[model samples]
Structure formats: C-alpha cells, structure tokens
Target: MKKFVSLACVFTMAVSVLAGCGSAKTETKAETTGETVAESTAAAGGKLIMATEAGFAPYEYTEDGQTVIGVDVDIANEIAKAMGKELEIQNMTFDGALLAVQEGAVDFAAAGISVIPERQENMDFSIEYATSKQVIVVKKGADVITSPEDIKEGTAVGVQMGTTADFYCGDLGCDVKQYNKYAEAALELMNGKIACIVMDSLPAEQLVAANEELEILDAELFTDKYAIAVKKGNTELLDQINEVLQTLVDEGKVDEYTINHTTK
Candidate 1:
C-alpha cells in the first residue's frame, strides 16, 4: 500500500463497474473561525439520518448494492451512537446528498464532502476530518497523459459531479463529463470513452484495484479537506457530529478505519 494515497489517497476515492445509488432527498450557520455556538438539546433516542453518495469508498460505497457502508458510514454511526440514536443512511447523488443536508431534508451528510467556500455558504461543516488529493486516473499504457499538463481541452475527462475533483478538473479546462456516481464514470473509462477520470485518491485506489486497466496518475490535481455537512445553523447536531469526529481523530480511529476499509 506504499503511497496508495490513503483516505489521503486510498479512495482514488472510487472504483468499480458495479454501481448502486439509492434515491434521496438545513440550517445552522457553522462558525468558520474554529468556534462553535453550542446549544442544548434533549436526549436523542430517535433516528439520526445521514445522506451520502455510496460510490466513494473506503469513505463510502456499497458491498451488497443496497447496504451502504464505509469509513464515512462508520463515522456517522459513531455520531448516532454518541447521540443515543439509530443511524439511517440515505444513499443518493453527491450533489443530492449535500442539498439534502442544506434543506434540512436530512440531519447531515458524509459523502467525503470537501469544504469549499461556496458550499460553506449553504451548509456548515464539521471540523475537517480528512485531507485528500484530487487525483487523475487513466487507462493502462495511455502514454499521452504522462502528467497533469498533458491533460488539455482535447482530453476528455470524467468525474463525479459536484466533487472537488469535478471542480479541479473543470479548472484544467478539459472536456469533462459529469456523472452522478464515480462508478458510472469508471464504466466510461473502462469502455475507453474518456482519456481519464478525476477523483479523490483513496477511492481512486479502490477503482484502479478493481479495474486493472485503470491506473492513477502520480501527480495530484489539487488537495481538499473532507468534513460532514449540516444545515447552516444546526449547532446542536453540528456540535455533536464534530465532537464524535474529534474523538475519532484524536483516537487515531479515522485513519485506522480508513486503512481497514481500504485494505478490505
């Protein structure tokens, strides 16, 4: 697993021809300056709902095509456990997951979501839990794209819509096809429909591992931070989510769960 890029890299953050996305469907203003406006709430012995696009693993991906599970799922479960609630996962598109969280349609979202300024306007994020390099994946023996610079307008690229990879790839000014799931983009890659795919590194590892014809580029497109997205003013839930996440981070469990999922 040398430099497999881990949650920092492991998920190239995606892979697989087998795709499963269930249907879907906020706000507490989160402080950006490392501060939390704590609030009081009653005991949580109910359902703690979370939205996610179950296509990015070891962060999130389905094994049975119906049951969504991964590092993000584990974290969400921990949040539920902390609140003394049951975890309910809603699997959907990456964009849909974020939107659901923003509209308060769900309690939160854990889609390996990157904390960009634009997103911050609509949703408050828990403290950054993981950092990832947006990576590029290409077919085996595709010598033309030896480096990021080689990817120009003529280079047709595929990406999961609304991901940091999608933004980074768009900046490259390449011809890009936006898919709801990286799984679909991977299908396109395997079919030789695109020159490459862009995504988080770790899931990219999973993708490449599953599809031998795919290979990750040594270069990175950009780096991003992953966090849980909640409504703008949901301080109670955001604080709880952050507390659980902080515990996981401090205990070194986040990286451990990430490694375990990737290795599995």
Candidate 2:
C-alpha cells in the first residue's frame, strides 16, 4: 500500500509539471504575437497606398501600355520618398479613389482632384498643386461652341461620371452623357456621339493636340484648384503631403515638370 501511494504521488507530480510547461509555452506565444502586432502598426508609418483615375492625362495616366506616368504620380512618388516610405499606386476611377481613402482602403489620392467645400466636408486636401479651367472640346474647324449658351438645346455634352464637369453641366442645364472614363468621353467626342466633351482645359488640350481631329473652344468655364485628397481627420498625413508639395513648388521642381511635359 505504501509503495502504491508513492507511485500515485509521483504520477501527479509529473502531470503538474507537464501542465505548467504547456502554460509557459502558451504565454510565450501570446507575448510574441503581441509584439508582432505592435511592430506591424509602427512599421506601417507613411507607407501610403495612393489611388488615382489613370485616364486623366498630364495629371495621372498610363504610358507605354504598362508604365503609369503623370504629374500626380511623379509628385506622389517624390512625396513618398521625402517621407521615407513606400508608395503603391492603385488605378481606380475618380469616385473609387475618393471612396478608397475614406474607407482606409488607401492612404490618400491624387487624381487631379479639385478642392471644393462639399468635398472638404468628407475628405482633407493638401495644398493645391495645379489650377485648371473647364473647357469644351469639339471637332476641329467645327463652329466653335465656345460657351455653354452656344450649345444647342438638343446637343449632348460628354463628361466623366462623378467629375466636377458633370456637376457643372448639370448646373448649366446642359444635356450630359456620362462616361466611366475620360478616355471614353474623348472617344465619344471623336465619334460624334456627343456634340462636345467638357473637361479640364489642360487635359482636353493634350487630348485634342494628340488626336488632331478635335479642338477646344476658346471660352473658359469654371476655374478650380486641384489638390491631393486624404481621409477626413487625417491631419498628420495631410500636413506631410502639403509640406512636400510646398517644397516642390518652392524649389521649382513643379515648374520643371510642367516645362518638360508641356506641348509647346
């Protein structure tokens, strides 16, 4: 009986030791996981995912069928480099770009986005990088439909959906046909599907110059300032982008890019 009791006690001691060992293993794993989470959060700093509508020429667009190149892309890259972070460009529609930043799907957006009070209510904006006026594009040598009033009552104006041009057309009571992309609208204008295409003057000029079949009216439409946009309340990121933008402007880098890319 004494020998049996001693053996049972030995067995109990072994089980307790194994259980304690298992607990220590679990605690170590938990500590490791906690530390990993903390490190991941810290390393995410300034590593930005930037979204843009890649169809907007001179601002953001694809080149050589593979490379995404534009003023916005260049500026964003410079900003990321200055911030000591990585930049990932997500090609998306203008509305999608805005939504991505708002939902934390992207860190920010730079799509030749115009800054307006309505948009400011939902998203933050960096310092304006470019200024543009709205313009109408039509077939070259066609009677210049220079002004909104010149558009015939039944004429249709093509515009990118969710853009300021769309809103401007609606406000002017002009008939509008919305396209998913700027290139689509430009194509429709080329095909005479729409009487005119309303867009930012700089891009419209670039497109018209390239196509040779289209021309822009001399009259100006609404003027607006374009800026990088971020999610509302993202003051840290907003301030950083603004600082970078101002530096570019002050150092004449912005002018250099404009001169290099502009069609003389």
Candidate 3:
C-alpha cells in the first residue's frame, strides 16, 4: 500500500513538472515574439517606399527595359542615403501614387508631384526640388495659338490626367482630352487627335526638340513647383526629407544632378 501511494505521488509530481515546463515554453515563445517585433520596428526606421509615375520625363521615367530613372529618382535615392534608409520605388500612375501615399501603402511619392493648395488637404509636401513653367505644345508651323484663349472652340487640348496641366485646362475652360501618359498626350497632338498638349515647359521643350512635328507656343501658361509628398500629418517623415533636401542644396548636389541629367 505504501509503494502504491509512493508511485501515485511520483506520477502527480511528474505531471506538475510537465505543466511547469509547458508554461515556461509558452512564455519564452511570447517573449521571443515580442523581441522580434521590437527589433523589426527598430530596423525599419526611415526605410521608405516611394511611389512614382514612371512615365514623366525629366522627372521619373523608364530608360532601358525596366530601369526607371529621372530627377525625382535621383533625389529620392539621395534623401534615402542621407537618412540611412533604403528606398524602394513603386512604379504607379499619378493618381495611384497619390492614393498610395494617402492610404499609407507608400511612405511617400516623388512623381514630379506639384505643391498645390488643394493637395495640401490630403498630403504633406516637401520643399520644392524643381520648378517648371507651363507651356503649350502644338504642331510646328501651325497657327500660333499663344494662350488658352487663343485655342479655337472645339480644339482639343491634351494633358496628362491628374496633373497640374489637366487642372489648368479645366480652369481655363479649354476642351480638354486627358491621357494617362505625357508621351501619349504628345502623340495624340502629333496625330491630330488633339490640337495641342499643355505640359511643363521642360518636358514640352524636350518633346518638341525630339519631334520635328511639334513646337512650343510662345506664351507661358503657368509655373509649378515640384515636391515630394507624404501622407497628411506625416510631419516626421516630411521634416527628415526636407532636412536632407536642404543639405543637398547647400552642398550643391542638386545643381550637379540637374547639370548632369538635364537635356543640353
């Protein structure tokens, strides 16, 4: 009877020990998970995913095959380097880029985004990296339509959708045809589907210089300051980007980049 009791006691102690070991294992797992999470958050500091419409030239565009390049990409890479972070570029449309940043799907956007009062409601903009004058592009030797008002009624003015030029077309009450890409808008103008295209001065000039079929109108339409954008209330990220941009400007890095990339 005493042996039976001793054996029962041993069994009970063994079960107790097993339970304690199980509890210890569970706690260790929880602690490990917590540590992993903390480490991940810390490592993610300043790491940015940037979105851009890869179709806008002199800003962001594809060069060879899948290689995206432009002023915005260069600036973004520089900012990331300054912040000790990695920059991941997501190629998207202009509207998609804005929506991604607003939705927190991206850390920021640098698709030659213009700093406009209307956009300020949804996103924070960094300091202006570049300024571009707006110009009208028409066929070479065509009737000189200097201003928006000079465009005859029913004349189709092509513009990239969701761009400053698109808004300008609406504001000017022109017969506007919006395209997804600036190249497409320029092509439509060349094909006579649209009478002309309204675009930033540099891009318009580049296109006109490349295509003998196009020319810039003598009149200036407007000017816009291009900025990188982040979600509204993302002041932390904005300040970091702005700080890096100011440093670059002070060091003349921006001027060097422009000189190297700008069409001569």
Best by TM-score: 1
lDDT of 1 by residue, 28-147 (tens): 223223332222121322688899999898998989999999999989888877776778999989899988988999999999999888899999989999998888889888675778
lDDT of 3: 0.80
Q: How high is the lDDT of residue 44 in model 3?
A: 53
How much does each candidate deviate from the true structure in C-alpha RMSD? 17.1, 10.0, 10.2
Candidate 1's C-alpha runs over 4 A off are: 1-45
lDDT of 3 at 93: 79
Best by lDDT: 1
* lDDT score for residue 172 of model 1: 69
What are the per-residue Cα lDDT tens digits for candidate 3 across 160-205? Answer: 8889888877776779898877778877777778778988887776
TM-scores, all models, native as reference: 0.82, 0.79, 0.80
CA deviation > 4 Å runs, candidate 2 = 1-42, 144-146, 151-154
Error of 3 at 146 (Å): 4.0
lDDT of each: 0.83, 0.80, 0.80
TM-score of 1: 0.82
Candidate 2 residues 1-264, lDDT tens each?
Answer: 999999999999999999999998787666556444334324556466899888887887776755677888889888788666778899977889988988878989998898877788889999888888888888875664656677645568898887888777877777889987867877877787788988898788788877888888888777978899999998977887898899998998876776655644
Of 2 and 3, the candidate ranking higher by TM-score: 3
